[model samples]
Target chain A: MENRVLEEWEIKEMLSRYGIRVPRGIVVESLPEKLELEFPVVLKVSDPRIIHKSDVGGVILNIKNYPDLKEKFMEMKRRFPDSKFLIESMERQGVEVIIGVIKDRTFGEAIMFGLGGIFTELYRDVSFRLIPIDEYDAREMIDEIKARKIFEGFRNIKANKDSVVDLLLKVSRLVTDMGGKIDQLDLNPVIVREDGAVVVDAKMVIIP
Target chain B: MFEHLLNPRSIAVIGASSDERKIGNVIVKNLIYFGYGGRIYPVNPKNEIIYGHKTYPSLDSIEDEIDISIITLPATMVPDAVESCVKKNVKYVIAIAGGFSETGERGAELERMILDKIRGTNTRVIGPNTVGIYVPRSNVSTALTLPERTALPGDGSIAFISQSGALGLLTMDTIAEFGTGISAFINLGNRIDLSENELIKYFEDDEKTRSIVLYIENFKNGRDFFNVAKETVMKKPIVVLKSGRTSEGARAASLHTGALASNDAVTDGALAQAGIIRAYSETELMDYGKVLAYQKPLYGDRIAIVTTAGGLGVITADYLVSTEKGVGMKLAVISDENKKRIRDTIVPFGSAENPIDLTADGSTEQYSRVLEILNSERNVDGIIVYALFQTAKVDETLIDVLEDNMKGKPMVVGILGSKMGKRMILEAEKRGIPAFPSMERTVKAIKVLYMRGRYLKRRYEDGEQGS
Candidate 1:
């Protein structure tokens, strides 16, 4: 709401509004005497202008206890004095997939799906569909990608296909609800476990 | 509105000449040789007669209303010719000149002048920098190529549109050679008056066009064209082979979404959204046209390949099953009942599997019998019949049985190699079955049929079909 580029928390809030589930996160403006939460949490810097969080030493993962959390938190605070930070529970390891939306000038709203996270950058394996996609189109898009094999599970994991389909349909609906204000949206590293999937990270760019 | 362009009743050849080497001479000669069933008025200031037709000094000299005026003159004189056409109430103008837009500033200025002249008038121009159109049914061809170079089209269901004139005609030659006919061919060089959007509507309105294929470099108005394509695809499949797919943005892109989704990715997505099938090559475009023009869109991906040879069927099975999961089609599991029928009908040693091999000993009776059993099986979405005429037992009779059996079902045919094979393939095509010389091409056509079916299913589910 304050800037053209929405930060991670803002994008997550937007996703929550569209019925897309994101990992539980809390933005801490001030450090308390004691942090009350489970271990194995992720802390990421919240900044609308910074596009890549990990590249800038802004993302800290796997702090097992309060001492480690506070130590990493203070280190990050010392590194960037003015930036806000968000701490959330780290999601269980699952198949990571990328779901995105790009407003094509020819066709109005186009959605993209593929294997997500760093490998998405390395391999560039992606598939696309126009918005207002139905359950059938969602299923087809899920099946169309080369990385579709990831959804079938690997190494003692079961396929979480229904969750992937639900996510795609929600993304499709989100594109429609954005009403053309949404220029692009990326939910990279969406953890898909056997039970369900969650948006581990999200970034959206409006008309800027 | 483009009906006159496709079915011009009378034409005036503006630079008609008697010299053999001149473009005007070749156009006039080509028109006469093709048996164009229309009145031709040859206009030339220098000649009193051209090819035995009485030549007038100008178009206004003709009393009849001119439907089209073919101008083969210098770029500077094109505007004046259009002025003449406007006065004559010419419905279409094919400017067979090359110096507009392609030759830079001065030529672009001349093109602008022609555009200025034809504004708010009935005169619609095809090109100022290119060749024109080809309509097989009407025998109306405005391309400058003579009889020796390009074979004229036979009447068929494909309506082809191309941005490049020469490429369009050469594609025409290739497709015509492949035993498919074109309903209409439009060369849209320097599309001054008409672009693809309006022509798309024109092709959609024409009941004769069952499928439309396009060769595009870039669109004049991409969104506008896509909107029209969305409307047309449910009724008739539009296959496009788009050029100019360079990874120009990959270097500047900052995110995986941006880098992975190239211009072509966006284009392909747009095309898919519109339900228009995109072909990667001209041959695939033609092959898609052949199947689309003849058969109905398949309802499923379960294909039943019936072949005389085992190797062809094996190869086809590989391609169909080798694709990614969603679009990957399977060889329909031939029911035991149908297998028994094949055994009862064909030789006992002949296989009764999905690729029901009639063996090298297959004859017309066996082909028809296997086709009947397959046709009766509801599990079979489409069939690919391979007729090897070289087997010494098969003859021209196979074509008759094939045309009869394949009438209502979606299908393609593959014949053996050689002159005999080409003849049989063309023979089957003449009777309205898409026949090819190789299994690869035939299976590819079948794959297109399956893709069309999937698209139709998606369209119906989306309810855009009613729109």
Candidate 2:
């Protein structure tokens, strides 16, 4: 029954350990140590205290070059004096699906799958299954969503449905492996690319 | 756990009275009027006889192996009555008083007093503030409602258990109107013992029950309840109507599970895991119960709609496809060969596709013949027939056609008209077709049938039930 939020880097580390794809990233309090090679990178204010970084303009995406990235990083540092920033290279376009695990008191941990991004709030199309579900159950969760048609390359938008299914199975296995140490996990907007699914924005509330 | 409580052969009404206004009087009178063949003992210290039957001044006066005793005394007198019933070696007891834990701390302490008295004895109590059990099979009727307002249901396979007393009676009353019999009904108010888990397990082997319906507000131990539900569903369907889903009730949750996940959503997951069909209203509860009890569970999603009205066929089709707000069911695509059979049977003007309309001039023969074809079709798993009686072509004889036909492949019949429609639907339901007058409701009934069908198929798929 963990109830405390974990840092974004810690969440990514756990996801990577479970073979869930995530952007290669690092955390830093200052701009000096090392620079990323990707041209268009994403810089996120990764303070555990800042649950909603976008709300505070802590997220500066598409920092096209090194100079602009440095200025934007310096500006974010000035606003949040003691905050740690996370930097990762931006990925390509893909479909967004949210995978969540909440430790329900009555039914224990239940896995949730639904359309992610802004459309998630508008449609609220989600389905739930209790944890320790098999790969077949994971596929059912993907098929349960009515908007699943989009996964079949709707309007020339390529998305490998099998990739999403694999992501669900891996996340389920990850949550089950953590047992009671993890209270709730939210991988909102887990982008489904042609080859595999990537955890775009991850948050975990650990059992305290 | 609940056999002795649900099917007690003999019962005694403590605080029995001859007066009409008293509940003691009502219990005794209902016992006799409801045709409970079991021996009835009226324990009244002030009277020697009640309604021409022998009455005793105390439990010690006269008794011959009491199986159940009803305590109708005040809250303060409950402990003494329970002690006396225990002394008489009663196996089950029903406390019909209200001033218990639901009242205040003092009342709670008094209710605890009764619980303390029954500790070492074999006597199990249903409630300190409840309506008790009603089983037509054993001739046990303890619902607070009088016979005049609603008669006890005949013997049937559907059993209902609820936590609300008055609501249980009202639910039973509503179910009785549908012509379905009651195998057992329990109003588990202020559950001291005999929770839903134990009762569900009790029905798992009971030969009389084919389906179980529950009206639950909360679970004493949710994990235990789900465990029992998982086992029970492999045998029969469980229909649940969960009340108090509003955020007001949800806000009082103390645990993180209650706070993080909505009660409604968590309950939905539980229901899905247990293969329970959740009912949105009282109507759907009985509606689903009727279908589950009468028709064979559906084996697939394909359904064919046969109706006299094209608009009704369209309405049912829209409802079937509107899965977001409703259960998504596929309309059966009739093959060209079968389509030709339908086309040849109906009038030339009538459409003979999936809907299989026989026009307003359609005869009862067309309706009957099309059902035979659909029944023999391998693609068709279930059907929804919109038999609107307003059309001159359809008549009461159509009921006979539907009744004799519809050979165990799931079917839902809907009729929308005045008295004729009402009479036809009721009559059709009496024959076990799960008929309704509204197209939306008919579609819902079809959904439940299909749900049960799919469940049964999966349940028996491997030919080996692990449990």
Candidate 3:
């Protein structure tokens, strides 16, 4: 089967349909007259070909006004001539974590939950389980990570563990519902606040 | 389900020989020495007497119907031998020779031929390169190792299944030396036919088996193995020691999820999800097995440490509370009323804190009284009693005290390793109280039981939530 990565907006749209929270975003071929979103928005090139958008200057964040949004959108469009632009309201930072699903060759459809960024890259602190998981498995995955102490309130950060569990259960269901169509799905830096979790960035690889 | 393989009424050693060095001789000697009750038929072309019993020239000559056949011939000869076993209608065949699929293409062809002969027949095969099985309960053993070299365990509850023959035998010896008994030991060399999944289901219903331990290098069907294990663990605990844990899967990964997963890390989670305790070493394999087999699941994490030595008490407490190395068990707080009750049992100098030190001069009666008090405390979920037999007042009677106080809650013993300590451990095991030679091992065994408890609780809630 040929695998293809879906555009970020499409992936986020799919996530929201499964009852997962995603940033309110829009994809446009050109800068719009006025945006429906609030101030302080983010503009990025929504091309599946670009994996690390920020690494290649495809992303510009924290645009406080429509003028900056329009300026950054034009600049991003100029940098990537063939790509469409994605504009969204900027989100406040929270505890960063990654939740993903991969159709594993051996175990098949396994869900992964781990701390995002350095904890994932350096410490490799993560836990996994075969998909179609229930509330019990979701709860256990939270406690299985090495830095589980973070969930109970680490210093100034107050991460809601229940929201993470809810996100995990929904992802598990999404993968289960998609079945063989999804090869991999990553919700990197899923901002987890005391109130709830939102998929700040998403990249999904689907079987075409 | 595998009655012919597990509880055969009669067995035939096809490559029966008189030479002491041969595998056939070792198998025959093990069977006779271990006191197998069923008929033993030795088949060889040479019509001679062997092991004080008449040998049949071929399997067909055994008129009573062979329940199983142990084929100890060369790889090239295995297919032909299997053909004859099938002709004789043998229910199961244990081919003990190597050089089958494990060798190369020629061997693979032989394995296929062997498989072809058994297809659509009532017969089943265990291995073309395997040491086969050892069941102490029925006095039946097909292990290729010399019986005198290893300390064979007697009939007990733990059933071990291994993919490697030598490791299985070596661990069996260690488990035996540690005073833990075995219900059965099966080696899945090359896994030509029977797999661990089937044995898991069989042992789940076996009256003699209380816990199942597996050492698998790879899986024939991982999903089926896990699914069967998930169902069986609700009835009995299953522990697995899976090697090759390196993150080989990460190199080929295209995403962070795949990259973060070492095949083993995913396997570890899946095993836990299925309620199987994962063991990292052979010692840990039996350590977890013996405890899970003998004791009930520890339903809570609150642990109380009772020791005669203050230093041992302090270390045990550290191990229980250290989340870095330990399972982060809470040091149970004993109420003031309970402390007063324990204080009256020990000497004036003895401390009645969480460890409840009884001092060096603590007596057997004092240990028993303190344990009785802790066992009754609702806050204390489990108890660890570190007994120093060298103390003047303590003796083998401490084992009886531990056994008696083991009524309402779970408890383990930590004894210093010595000649007397070995005897105490054996005695404690005989009475069904898991006693370890070290404090860490004792505490870690409790962690395994605690994990089992948590899994059971999760599963119970799963059922309560309706699936």
Candidate 4:
């Protein structure tokens, strides 16, 4: 396996190589002729340099078909001309999880995992452990998150426990392997589907 | 400014009067009282002799090298006095005068002038309205006021920085009373030059400072403070007591130091993000400082409470378990089943469940029995014992029991009773056990210990995963 700073596509490619599931998508620098996916697909600016796409109105979602996708793509292109766009099939129902690395000045690299997608910052319900976490440590991180109850099948929703745990361990391993080379890697919405999980969108800040 | 303030070889007190009531006189007396080994220079422009030492007219008249110049003069003449000391090449100047910055516009302007004069020079000023600095390892205290009578120079473990001069002095007095020594005590009054964050970064690598305690009313730069704190706390435990938590307190802090008290919730979140423990009160500040100064980090939340009184033990257990989502731990009140296992050696009446209530009539022997049983239990990660020495029957025995049983356990003790009971509590402290008179203090201490333990366990578990 290559150990270098990976861009958005490069990271997804590496994750796919590691047998981790990622949302099927295509990157386009311009508006596509016609959308290939079904309705309710996600369109996001796919520049690795842009960490928070939603903050800058760089994401458009739930387009029904080709007409809607073309209109949204044109609007996004008008706003961020230099940015590449990614269109992927959306995972409608799944628990959102975030996996990232924070370089703790004293202890060096620390991997953090918790409930994600907007609520992460609002609740700040995250747990941190040193990098290269194992399955047991990943399980402990899941338990420490404030939304742990939700992950335990709360509110008539059965959580995909095995997939979520596997995703956390894989993210931890990826961060440890990258070491100081990657400043931060955020998989904001790792959807925990009923039978499996998928990394829908992710970003990484590489050290210059 | 004199070089002796930071690296003092020889020091002298100008205007060092014999009178104990004046600031000048107090400086001279405390230096001798703290046992300074260097040459003593007591200069009073008026008196030819003071404190049994020949008084010189000024820094110019002093024949020897003056590394430090501590000026305690009237506000108007301070600038001129500083200039005289500058000519003498005094590298460190600790201006203990209070009129500047604290006495309104004119004083603030005077302070600016002082700063302007000191600029572009090797001389650094500690405070214009300050309480001096203390280096315990060298028996040096440049502050005008002395700490509490009980305080002695000890092996330094914690470095303290305070924005308030009076609070800094008060904290030193408190530390002295508690028999804890500090590596350094810095009072950043008005913060005309140095800042709390700079001191934090300085102490981050200092071998003498094991833990850092900060009493801050405001931050010069909140983001910078957060980043430095995040880095520092992971290496050394950082406990902070932000004084202006309430609106009223914020107003008071603003008037005191011109600090804009940020919203309490935001500050709390930011502090937590940096892993800095926010202490609610002065009592918690000292209590946590003491705990973090000594105890090892806890590994888990599971606690085994051993108390002579059932009520106190139950209260402690309830607190440990009762959060928003029911009880966090499965509290086992030392039951008869576990008691039976140790009954051959211990008394039959002792409860064997988690809160091992040895009964009110419990002696040190009973404490030994309960501790031994709890320590042997796999579920117990730490222990909190409430030892009440109400009568002579269990007083001596309790001390012996605690001394023997509390060898390696992460334990905290709460003692409840009158003045004599408080004395017994101090004796327990003397035997390497931190005993508090109030149950709340005991609980808070245990919680801090538990927090540290959790930090350690998290690191250990994560380290294993990383490996």
Candidate 5:
């Protein structure tokens, strides 16, 4: 309660309370002798101390088999010995979106949504609203951002509006339910496939 | 600190001079002319008497208790004046002199000297290089004069807090022209001791304050500000006009108020999260404030526009509906059944479908019918009436109809011509209704009201969860 920041797993648990979908994932400090997941899984260092896993080469994606997974896991451990690891099922890509909450000086806990992955930082297209956004407000925040046009079917791909709205609503509800306990929560690269959406990766920081 | 600043009864004007050009002289004149009921003493070592009132040579010589002392002396003399006021146990001091921290390092040192003098004492200082406060209700005008005495001195609903003294003065003048008064006006220049967040917290419990407006350049404490704003907004509407948003603005702000400006993205995100309406311009700020301050909060976002002209009606309706795209609110005009019934009862050719455009040949009776139908319609949450006041058949009769039907519901009137619209505008204001000069402003006001209304509803619902 003293810290307002939530860890990644805690954020996932909170989002689960709001009925948000996330990829099947499990946390482990050490690599298991026998891997349970199928081929083409994604594994990343899940240490709360590490903010950017890809920067440190802690993320190993598209592992085709068990040998590849073992080799990548060993490499990741060798590179970062103290870091915890998370094994998650790789998700199919349709559209990528980033959703987070940033503590603002003038306005309080602001929820943000934008086009995700590299486009999010490169394009810097995002929309924000005050925390505890209702269902209507969540829908509005999604539509207000410039990246919303991409969600309305960009180029040849037909955009999934329902999934985008659903994601925003759930995120809003998550932030609302967490109240002042959560400082910042980032769910990047939320894969919005034709049928549904799943959060592929997340980072949460508790304020001390 | 803000409470002591705003509610001070007895005041002393330092650097009191007989010359009208001096800041001290103007402040004394403003306080006296504005009819400050409390005792006003002039303190000047040089002048024996200022404006025919006996001036005290020093704070020690003054026998009466001073709740607030205004320092309008030179930069070098400010420390001594503050020392004198502190020794006299003055609770609040508003330093109107310039050449403080805003100047440079040397001036900043001098500003620190002033702050050091009042550090732990009960005495709180407002500004060392700033304009001062204005409480029309108390008839306290401590700022430098501009010719805008149009603001009525009564308990008003809007409270304005600005980082810039000049902008605060300008806003006072501008809002006065709109015939709206303010409960309290403050300029928190440099915010050396008092900040916007503290003022907002004070306003949260203020019964006289219905809506709060701010012109902020930077936030000294972002997290503290957010927490207070989030809580305060649940009590009253908070509208912020945040300047220094762009890179150039940030640089300029640093020079203006010594504000370490943050990135625009962070500021925007923060404002959105706080549920505070961020206005782009002074005009928009006042427009939003007027709607939030005067009109009753709307129950829903569904607006029913009633216009005399088809083109104007269409434009109004379009703007109202389009603005709510992201907000997910709907605006539909009165239905055909209600429209036809109104037309048959009032005007036979009035067009249906929300806008309820009565053709050019329509009369006051048609306007009345449209209002009656919209009032009875369950789908309509609010109404906007656009009338061509210059038309031959159109007269005060439409105003009368509006006056009768506009009770317990929010409605805005847009008069076509300014010259002929004055009478109607006055009448509307007298009736506690807002009348805009243009269709664009009318639509914008309605949109703000709708947005604010929705936010308020959400805040209340969220509050219930906590209870």
Candidate 6:
């Protein structure tokens, strides 16, 4: 079966269905008259073909007012004429970590947790476990990383470590339910704050 | 399940020869030399007697029921030989030949033929391209490797399972020098029937085996192996030295998770999650195995260093806390009361801090007293004793002190030097005390014990919650 990357909005909908917290967002073909969400929103071109949306200027962050959101949405619509636009709430900056799921050829479905953004590839500080992990396994994944000190109030950042553990178990259950149909799922830069954790961006590749 | 295979009462050596150079001859000689208590039937049509024993012309000719059969013929002739063993209702067959599935497709077809002959019967195959097994307690050694270099180190707790015959024999050959012995060693060449998983399950329940060590290049059935390993480790610690860690062995992946998931990284994580310790090299494999087998798991990472030389104590302390090579252990704190007790036994110049230094004038009596205090100390989780024999007063009597102190806390001795010192190290190992040549090795071995301890604590806590 051919693999396809799910669109940004589709991934958010899937995450919410699995009880994972994602930024409140809407996918619109055209700019609406007024915004229902709070000000300072994120505008992005929701196209499945775009794997690195920020690299191609498909994402515009921090629109302060309604006119700015409308202008940014129109600009993104023109840039990718066939694609829809996602307007999301700009999340508060917090501890950034990446959580991913991949169908390993030998061990089958496995989950990965690491320092998110460029650090995910730069330091390569990640830990993995075969899916259907327990609370202990999730906790170990968090502690195994070299940069694990980040969760324990690294510098100015302090994250709710328990929320990350909760996120891991929920994702494990989600991947376990999806089974062999899901090839890969990446929740990059999942902003883990003192209060809770949110998946700021999600990318999924499925066998269907 | 592998009673006949492990400790056979009677064995038939098919294609057994009188020539000293042949593998067949070596098999028969090893059995007799190792004092195998069972009956031995040498089967060869051309010879009436081989190795000073009456030989049978064929399996049908032997009146006694065979518990196990060793086929030392070439790969092409293995099927017919297995066919005879099956017709005779032999329980197990150890096919010691080189050519099989390891060669190519045609060889795999030949292997399948051998498998087909023993499909419904009681017979099980060990290898068509393997060295078979060695059980010291049963006095059975079927390895084709030379007896002199690959002499079996008499019975001990570690059960070693290797995928490569030569590597397995080499490790076995050197383990004796390290003062470690194997309860059993089975080489899983081509893995037609018995693989590491089966051997692991067998050793888990075996009273002789305390810990299991594996040298696997690639798993035969990875998922099944993982499942078995997950359950087995809760009972006993399992250590693996899996080769092919480089990126060259990695599969090209399109997704980020797959891209980051290199062969070694995934293996490292998977093994850890299952509570199986991974060793990067052969030395690490044996070192981890020996330590896990001999010592009880530490309760925490806090460690105490007892040494005759202050320099050795300092070096050990450095390694104990070294971020890169260390396993996150700290210099154990001693209460003032315990510190005064240690001080009263040692010389005037000796220091009584975390790395308790006994100075060059330290005697075996001092060591005995210090170790006794440390063993009773609540702050210390484990102890690394630098049993330097080069000192004036420290002599062979220190080995006795180490043995006596071995009961309460996990202690590893670091001793290295002339022939006399090496013998002392071996002596300690024979007594089930882990002793190494260098401070680095001693610290690394302690790391393995610490890892096992941490893993067991989590497993037990989870179990308690469940119940």
Q: Report the number of the highest-lDDT candidate.
A: 3
Ranking by DockQ: 3, 6, 1, 2, 5, 4
Candidate 5, DockQ score (0 to 1): 0.23
Tens-digit lDDT track of model 1 for A95-176: 8888888766555577888887677767767777778776776777777676676666546666588988898898888778
lDDT of 6 by residue, B208-252 (tens): 899999999988877777899999998888999999888544655
Taking all chains together, each candidate's TM-score versus the true structure is 0.92, 0.89, 0.96, 0.70, 0.81, 0.95
For each candidate, the alpha-carbon lDDT, in order, equals 0.82, 0.80, 0.88, 0.70, 0.75, 0.87
lDDT of 5 by residue, A1-208 (tens): 4543344666676667778888777778787887676667898887766666777787888888888888888888888788688887788777877777666545556677777766666666777766666665677667767767676677767657787778877776766666665566678777787787788877776656
Query: Residue-wise lDDT of candidate 2 within A39-139, one digit each (tens)?
Result: 68899999888876788998988889888988999999999999898998887768888888877666777878888877765666777777766555676
Better of 1 and 5 by DockQ: 1
TM-score of chain A of each: 0.92, 0.95, 0.96, 0.89, 0.89, 0.96
Listed models, DockQ each? 0.43, 0.29, 0.68, 0.05, 0.23, 0.64
Residue-level lDDT tens digits of model 6 in A14-35: 7899888998888889988877
Candidate 5: which docking quality band? incorrect
Q: Could you give candidate 5's per-residue lDDT for residues B92-203 as a string of tens digits? A: 8888888888889988998789889988887777876778889977788888875454343334678988889888887777666545667898888877777788889998
Higher-lDDT candidate among 2 and 5? 2
Stretch of 10 with least lDDT, candidate 5 chain B: B252-261
User: How far in Å is the alpha carbon of B299 misplaced in model 4?
Assistant: 3.3
> Best-fitting candidate, measured by DockQ?
3
TM-score of chain B of each: 0.95, 0.93, 0.97, 0.82, 0.89, 0.96
